[model samples]
Target: MKILSIVGFGGQGKTTLAKAVYGHLKPRFECQAFVPVGQNPDIKKVFGDILIALDEQTYTRPKLLGLDENQLMGKLNEFVKEKRCLIVIDDIWDKKTWKLVRCALQESNCGSRLVITTRIYEVAAYADEAYKIQPLSHDNSEKLLYARIDDGEGKYFDSLSAETCERILKKCGGVPLAIKGAFLAEELPEEVGLLTQLVCLRAGHWDYSWIDELPEEVGLLTQLVCLRADDYAIRVPAGFIGKLTSLQELRISCRGKDAIIMQFVEELGLLKELRVLKITRICRSESIESALLESLGHLHNIQELQIGNYSLSKYRVSEAGSLSYCRHLRLLHLDRLVFSALPAWINSSLAPNLSYLDVQVVVVKDQDMETLAKLPELSCLILHLTGTKLVSVKLLAEGVGYFRKLRFLKILGSLIRFDVRGSECNSSRVPSNNTIMPGLESLEFGVHVRSLKDEKLQLGFDKMLGFQNLGTSSLQRVKAEVNCGGASTWDVEEAEAALEHAAAVHPKHPTLLTNRVESQYMISRYQEV
Candidate 1:
């Protein structure tokens, strides 16, 4: 047994270092498990997680889920009896839980290795060798502080003096986590009200199991241009973020549904200067849903927005037209939401400035394609269509220089066909004054296939190649994802070979890749572009 322990102070990076070592050694072992035991660890859940992580192939998922703690330990013991395993148990706060876990791995004499990370010295004494984590040096601290001091427009750090940098480092005391939390607060005077001028702020890593709410003082930073409170649960006070009149970028993840959070979303429209906003963990709420649809119409200056509902169940985009006034909007990503067809606002008159759009839908229509083609500035587009049958859709049809600036396009879903045989889309014709996606550089197709002799897939590849040649031929990469729906895997192999050969003949000789989902065949070819 190769046993190692990582011991450190509360904020001295014990778990971080343990994860690094686990990632490096995982591939060398026959089976691997990494489990986090928080301050108040749940022993039963921890053992269950270990069994699943170790790849217990002898039992079905349903059977494993139903196993008791003793049965789970038996399954884990059986799995590692004949195979070498690597295990990491992170952030153990007490000895009782460790003893419980030790009972499961005690007699598996298969040359297994274990790594434990803890804040207590007693836990470290249980291992063969203990590694101590240290604080960062002054030079390293300076580099980290300087890299994170950027204002929204990059003016804040450029004006920071050497004396100010030294003062901030001394206050951090060489601890990494402390350095992150205590940034800029010491050098800037409170009487001068520097927080009002601050733009970007990233809170320290939070463990939500203990911490539940944010400081009310956060609402006073009225001039904040960007804010990121990732993976932290916060109870929002009414009009908290709306006070930041100049705020342009905000990224936050909420834990559950609350009326306070809904009010915050409703008031977001008051900050007309916002250009980028991303919000996650949207649960079911009628008030929250109404506020979202009603408030988005007021963001006239919005540019990039990403909204994700929990899943495809109850979420609906009923008022997509609310974004019609977002003339500067680009790079929109909506996940696990349902829309009947393309929204009407995706037209030249409404959202001409759009450069990238990613959305999921159940069906698409011809007018949707026409409207999308008219987006003169569109460069990248991803549509993940899911439904009964995502059969046919026309792309870049005959037009007056539609998709002229398109550079990348990805379409993923069940089996679909591309009809490019129309005379208007004749790829053999000489490059006329008008062209489709002339700047196109990469194309990806993901389709569900019944067999390798999938004629629709083969024909789609042929047409896609022709589509690539019609462009600048500055094409640098092509990828195809084939999801198998039948027993035979030979067809996917042949398809991959054909794609590789096609890529070989291109003038630029771009990189080509074919990934077979049901089987384990992946072909990647890289050539000089």
Candidate 2:
């Protein structure tokens, strides 16, 4: 993988440029991983955020890698061997953070790339490709600023006297972020003051590096960001993500990730809009977490809370505060964790909406499941179990039918059932043996043990049937899957033909099925084959 850095002074749009590159490059890596690196970590929350971003909702640190950075990198190395990935390092502050992450990044393929943004030019020099962020010209700067507020190039541009426009652009310094910062800071009343004035002050003063209090429209640009509806549900704007009242879903990994968070959160004021927060590693004393959560008492609507790179040591474990206030929460992915025991500060009622929860190193006491499953939204759950003790998946599945919503479950590195036993599975009334799920549109289950190629093929078919037999409301089975990759159409077609034949054999399964292997995609299927 090649390291590339986008470097320039603050407000130069390094992040914006990096994001554009990431948007263009992410598809190249099937197992792509992206994180904004930050300082510090707690033992318990290390892997949750990475897992979440990888779409591995059930990710938990393996027992072998508990708090050992090398061991962790070793696992990432294995993933690199299996598939290509892209790791984005955003707003990197120092060299040590680079060192710690660089080891894991080394696992990608030759063409895999690293894209980083930093204020320091030295950091850019370390990268294979460096891009410097530059400011807009005097004319383009005015064009860009005015482009933001008014609808278009009509009277808004014509009415703007050249002299006034120049002065406004000068105040904004022709930097994109600052222009965005000011334009986004637009609240009608506050904008009234700026537009009517002969000389407008930049909303965030570059001289003092401070954001001035503005009217509501301009104010929304601070903590309350304007985000699309879908984004608010899954990924919110960088500014809005920090301001959520209850961090039901948050994973902030970098050092300043938290401070950047508080700045926006104070601005947003927990106004019922936020839902998920993905945090990086946060390092306040053990007493801070509970206190921090307390401030979030007003957010009762959050459904999923993710703490990126959650460590065991940095926060207080109390039964009080925001953690307990989330009455609607269903999922929690706590990464980089290292707590010996689960704290009592959490309660089932707090996560009444919780369906999926991934945490680091918890011994899944019977008590934990008992409280966890009772949640109204409880359904799918994954526990990495970062320990040696074995626990039966069936035994775990047996209790949660009241959470009939609870169906999908995963226990990573657990000795309970290395292989799913028919007897054990059939024994559960919850359809554990059925190997199928009802009301599920898509089913993606993976088993990583070494299996013969033939066995792997057979198992794949068997698993598909298992899914259909469980009887979804309207049975949904593997259908029309386009496997895109490789260097030739013939190779892709050959593979697709084989898959289509397999689907054809399953007459009892869902009918509609087609397979098209695509070349010019990211990675070829045969790489692993």
Candidate 3:
């Protein structure tokens, strides 16, 4: 038998950590119970709850209602003395409560375990072993913030600017609860307006739950430099954003009526000092589209811009000639928005400082590729093909030199065929050594398999020798999502084998991850190798 206690201040994740440990070890015990004893817990009620949790089938609420604290203790001692059990008593406030609870659980030779969580150090020291929990570190704080804000998808978090992330983390001060509450809270307290000197504020729910209203008091924070609210249902009063003229970075989303969203877009034109702007969940309309384009033209100082409607549908903004006005742009992410082709203004002369680009287009023409390759500082590129027909694109040895500084490249499309120049030989043989993306560290692409006999679509384990042609020395991670919708059992096996073989042959031996997608329209579940 053993007792372990965890001590920590409020909001340091003591309960969260205890719950995780309990979940992992509960299956090994004969019986398990988790009971929370708050500041003024009723002794009889706490004991009764534990008895019910340990034997739900036998301990009915009606049957236990008649028992007093002494009777409940008698039942608990008799039950636990014979059975090996795991119990967690969370949020104990005082030593008196602990003594009563401890007396009820009889010591046994059945190899039982007891865990407790408390904010009181002396109470925790009463256990056989005490663990003092500490606040999260800087790296873990960032991970937790991103994980909560993105809801595990990680698409939005990756595109965030370093300056914005740092400001939010500093505000959270390494507390796990503060980090999570900063983004997940449903509504701010009315007193939030009192913090008139606050320079940064980030608040919203990840699940897109409808908030009744954003406190109009938020407009009082005129000194805020960074403000982010991701809730889609927030209806900003007409002049709410205009009040925060000092804001350098702003992110907001709305999925409500069209009139509300149109007004929100028009308000952006007032922020002359804005450096980063991200707006999503927009309901596209002719009037709103015109207003959105006009607003983009006004933000001359903007350095990063992200706009999209997410999964609602592919938003069409091909006529956005106003994008040419923001010459200082270094990062551009157009999520799920489909254009006929690359925007005419996306060239070296217009966006000379461009480094990171993510876009979805119907077809990537030769001229479009040429324009993208000319980006002097380009480092990360994510391209998604949305055409109905198969689009064949080639990466020639000579053209590979253009992406000398590129480090991360991801191409996503089931109907696109990527043919590397020197990798056209037989599946079993290695390709001629032709290094591509010499500085690349991460590579991700999609593969579509319709049949085993079709040579054009055969990217099975044997046909994946194209990886050898990449910058193997700098490569660190490779991910492939194979769609096996119509392929037979043998074809799936061959594809998996090919991925494993490719990973093994690499001289640097980068970590390999394969996502075997069973259908084209379904979500992918990844399997790491």
Top candidate on lDDT is: 3
| Ranked by TM-score, top first | 1, 3, 2
- Candidate 2, residues 8-82, lDDT tens digits: the string is 888888877877888888877775566665444322243334544654744554543345566566665566556
Question: Which candidate do you rate higher for lDDT, 1 or 2?
Answer: 1
For residues 181-267, could you state the per-residue lDDT of candidate 1 as single tens digits?
Answer: 444332233221233455565542433232344455667777677776545544445657778788888777665447777778788
Clashes of each: 1, 58, 1
- What lDDT score is found at residue 361 in candidate 2? 43
What would you estimate as the lDDT of candidate 3?
0.74
Model 1: lDDT of residue 508:
70
- Model 1 clash tally, residue pairs: 1
Provide the lDDT at 58 for model 1: 53
Using TM-score as the measure, the top candidate is: 1
- Model 3: per-residue lDDT, tens digit, 308-399? 66656556656667777757988899875677788887888888878889988777875677577667767889988763334545555453
Q: Compute the lDDT of residue 68 as modeled in candidate 1.
A: 78
- lDDT values, one for every candidate: 0.67, 0.48, 0.74
TM for every model, in the order presented, reads: 0.56, 0.40, 0.55
Model 2: how large is the Cα RMSD against the reference?
A: 22.3
